[model samples]
Target: MRVRHSTNLTRNGLTDWIVQRVSAVILAAYTLFIMAFFMCSVDVTYASWTGLFSNLWVKVFTLLTVFSIVAHAWIGMWTVFTDYVKSTAVRAFLQIGLFVILFFYFFTAVLAVWAV
Candidate 1:
């Protein structure tokens, strides 16, 4: 016997899929900029680091980077949780845990950058 599957995809799922791809592209561009900045700062010093962070453009870029990372990780984690976890309770718990960890790191990075 042969089985057939539905061809239609859920709207939310498709939205999430599109968002993930867009986020990936944004992340790629951001990563390249960060890599270039680091490479150019080979002779790094406290003053040099502070100077980079002190710029308004750099601060805005950092905020965008953090937002993109959080968004990408959230979507990726949600996909993993949905695919692998069979129980609803388990999936919810895992997602909550992931959010907590992500938020903590996000805030920490924000504070560190702001302090610079």
Candidate 2:
């Protein structure tokens, strides 16, 4: 038997499953992008770093990657807490705390990425 929580962002096991898988792919792609950039560049310098991010597409993709990371983390953490933290109050508190932290992380990432 599966337990369903009303406060879930996905609210369905299948949806959550799919989301985790998709987010993993997005994260993997982002990692590959960084790896490829390093491999193709002769020297990793400040200018090269800035130049890579200067592209609008790179900025957009970075934002998407950050968002994917937050979503993936939220779902993964929520699942763990819900499964092990049997107390409703404790689970709710943990989830809310994690949500706030993830939101802040994403917000900081956006500002750092775009300086906006």
Q: How accurate locally is residue 20 in candidate 1, as Cα lDDT from 0 to 100?
A: 72
Measured by TM-score, how close is model 2 to the native structure? Answer: 0.93
RMSD of each: 5.7, 1.7
Candidate 1 clashing pairs, residues 3+ apart or interchain:
none
What are the lDDT scores of the predictions, listed in order? 0.74, 0.90
User: In model 1, which regions exceed 4 Å deviation?
Assistant: 1-11
Q: Can you give the TM-score per candidate against the true fold?
A: 0.79, 0.93
Model 2 misplaced regions, further than 4 Å: 1-4
- Candidate that scores best on lDDT: 2
Model 1 TM-score, all chains together: 0.79
